[model samples]
Target: MHRPAPTHAKHCCSLPSPCKECFLVSFARGGSWRPPPCPLAMGNTKWADAGQASAIAGRRRERLIPRSGPPVRSECLDGKRGETGSPHQLEGKTMKAVMYTNRRADRILQFTSDFPDVDWAVVWSPEEFENGVADADLVVLSNRICTPELGAALARGRTDRLRWVHFSSAGIERGVNMGLPRDIPVTTSARAKAPVCAEHAMMLLLASSRRIWEIRENQQRHYWARNELNFTMRSIEGQTLVLVGLGGIGAEVARKAKSFDMRVVAVTRGAAPTPDVDDTVPRRRMCEAFADADAVIVATASDPSSFRLIGSDAFAAMKETAYFINIARGEIVGESALISALRAGQIAGAALDVAEDEPLDPKSPLWDMENVIITPHVSAAGSTNDYFRLRALFAENLNRFRAGRPLDNLYHFDDGRALPATN
Candidate 1:
């Protein structure tokens, strides 16, 4: 018998749980933390040993921060189809869905090879969409859909066939502003992001320890004059690490950060304990956490409350030698403030993979700084499979939707521009 749908307020996911599922949410939360509105905690993991994790200096730990926001509405199995018009209220302009547009070359290759059966368009410009987007079956918008015109195109395609979109990256900052169609299911590239980001965070931490970048500069200037070492090089074996944002990518960064024997502390919405996270703290106390950290890695997803989460004040509070690494969104930190922190030597340095204005201009002053290392939003992505993998995950979710099975990565009901569920 079909059990009466439980009230949305009592549980997370705002619905009954799915069984025999490959995509799962697993964690301990005293039974109050249900899976909905995205995760507040990841699976709990034990701290790593400094003795076994060779050549590492810091201890490993993790934590969480309670986040507050309006509780999103939930729906039943077959809610009414969303209205066919621009979701203009969310963006204050029209939003439109577009086609495949991942930046990574490998993901492009793998996605095409895997989805040979699905007929999809790979349009590069809006001008090429002459027939108008409403007629298209599906628009596989990659990460590049952060523009106002693309928003208009998305606004134009407010009908059937615009059911799903596989975002190119895991950050979801672009998605928060996309005004996703209410009925369409938007999924993230989170699964594909974890490992690559973990590796990058670890690399920055290790590089800082070995003095690789500064050593290179001395060599380039041919300054071979002998002198006593001025600064002490630290080890990862017994120091502390505080990771901001404990989602898929953040968790992976934590696991690897632990492998280096560093303590892992994390901040997330709704105070709850999860595997690998130590001490649950509030966002206000983040600077205090940083003051004691040897390395700080931020891998948070972009949400309404997260814009400009870090600024110069936080940097000023950090130890002068501490290294700050951001593999998350760029706007999360103030660029002007970052420059001030680095130039005044308030903090040792920063290793950034993303910037406020991405593909940072060649004329930007960040290029001239000796203490900062900037990569063109390349650290968190590693393979072409992130796209193919996301597409396949979406395909599986599509199958579930068709079978009247529960959906995975269901965009929490908020303001979105979606089509009727496409099974």
Candidate 2:
């Protein structure tokens, strides 16, 4: 059954100029009001009851009108509303959005209920997604449930109704590789995840610099080796740190690194000086900058051109005592080259939060290396704070989408990267 229109005056017409005859206004003005005749009343002019009239009225209001003008008198289901030629507005019809998520269904429903005009469907599995996406006007995708096959299906199965695709995570390289429809606008939650991921990178850098694994080994043996480790222990203070790809994550890392008195040099396409970076070098001269760094971090996006961007030559360019850390996608660094660099002691040590292939081959030599620290890609794992940030970002974007405004963190299909945040 259709839901009833709101009875309160404030909940009546949201348009700029509401019709004077709208019954909701009469209710507020303490004037006598009667149910209007609905076309759906069994082909009769009169409704069966007040409840039936309300249901019909609610359905009519669900058909969204243009934002700029007064409400127009038009048929609800006949598609005869005023045309604004705006991609954002869905004239004369309600929008249906299908979201694939692992979040609790009740929570999603409660949040979506605020917008009665939108029909929201939340699915938990790939099978449900295949069935639910058929008539959807918008799709909210979770990274955990996304795959190349599903991406291809989405691209192929897209209808004229499909307008936008949103990712709940920072990384969209995998989504880009999924062959999503290029014409539809795509966005991500990268801005929300940057600070947490940067903190994780700093943790890895500090642990690697102090040789935490060796300290743990001594503790396990019940031995005191303070003097033995002291000579080798290093501080990040006054060391030069180089960052590749100064996007959201990179910028955050640079800002935090400066707090430790580290000199930050960033390699980016832009020539403008960044806030936290002490020096900026073009991508072509990144190797020259690497030669002077005491540590290097990979925080760039992964694309075809950037695949294996830090290979043997790049590693060989770093100082022998310099540490290497990869908090970004593993494919951005050649795994074999990194392994070789570690084995030959070309660099002091390395830390990895992501791998080229996750669940990283149990037999891989990196597992046994004394100098290497490997985490199972849990850098952005603060559930409590992350949930709120992701929700706020999506909600803001949804509002912008309805208002015909440009979205934040828009993913570029041509480059397989998000538009860098202007602020």
Candidate 3:
């Protein structure tokens, strides 16, 4: 049967929608629960029946939609089904949501603590659909709420009345992992990661150029290589750096690359000039960039379309003398292709903050390579309020959401995935 479009989406992305990602961390999910009535749902013309008043529906659990796919960008790979198929963005309103929780009661409280104005419900023990869970304007999926059932419940809970979603961590891949509906306006806390990742990129660049890891390895072998021929340090000044996928992290990477006087060229789907970019090229021209740059950095976020965005052919195009760095997600680069690139010297060397796999196995050959430098995902690690700094930005956005102001950090909704390029 045909249904109407979401009334709230029309207002969702105006201005800079920066504060929406933290809503994910605050959702309190229950097995088979009903979603809260969205404040914006009132404006929607797709009513279950006229005179069926939301007040009556609020007394009983009304199923507005079904939870059938991934949490964010969970649009069917084939095609969206039902009335919820097309993308609907929520803007100019604070979406009310029930934050889910379980054993991590403290975390649940802390997650929603910042959003004091939100009328939130508490669930000590989850039921197979708390029926009342969906009574709010939106739902917050806290760290405690992770389950196939909860994912399903969330899908059902999303409604036109609900206008916002927030992800606790920088990645909504977890929501993707659980199969969320791509219909929702899902945003990740990735904006919060840019500055830290920028710092990480700098560290990796400096480490590779100065041969820090190599020096440490040589010292571990009870030898010195600082004065060795291959160990000679190179200054970052006057070097050419090409950055791929100039999103938040890439833009930040460019800002930092300037400290060393490196020339920066960026290739991205946006095809628009960024603040710190010297040249803004398209993705197809990336290989040409590789050939011209002395170092290349990949800082785009992860998604199915972005998987292995850089691979053998691109690597083959790089200058045999160029260095490569990845401060972005690992899947952006194909695994075997990268390994071969180093083994064959398609590129001079590489440094990575992320990998195709976590805890890169001890058996992995990349660890043995002399020119490669690797670190567990510590590129974003900073002491003190680093994490809260990210969350705080999101919370501030939430306040903006409630006030009906424009939002920042709005995700570009393509046919399905969230691309950096805005529609």
Best-fitting candidate, scored by lDDT: 2
What tens-digit string does per-residue lDDT give for candidate 2 at 1-423?
Answer: 223433434433444333223432122111123422211221112112232222223243332111212111211112222111223337655677887776674233433543434677887766677677888888887666678767766766568888888887778777776777788888887756776899999999999999999999999999999999999899999999999878778888998899999999998866356678999998889899999999999998888868898999999999999999999899999999999999999999999999989879999999999999999999887633454345445554565566566676788776666763232
**Better structure of 2 and 3 per lDDT:** 2
Q: How accurate is candidate 2 locally (lDDT)?
A: 0.70
lDDT of 3 by residue, 1-423 (tens): 224534545422221221121111211111011222232232332323222222121243222331112111111112221122223234544334565656553433554544444455655534533453555556555432556776666666555565566565555555665665556456555555566788888888888788786688778899966568364677789888999876657777888888778899998877457656788878788888888888888877677768889999899988887889987778788988999999998887899878898778889899988889998988767633345445444544454454444444545445223433121
lDDT string for model 1 (13-126, tens) is 433431101112221111122432322211221222223221111332221211111111122224322111112221232333345453454344344433333444565655
Q: Candidate 3's error at 394, in angstroms?
A: 2.5
TM for candidate 3 is 0.68
Lowest-lDDT window of 10 residues in candidate 3?
23-32
Residue 33's lDDT within candidate 1 is 24
Residue runs of model 2 more than 4 Å from their true location after superposition: 1-89, 102-117, 420-423
Evaluation by TM-score, superior candidate among 1 and 2: 2
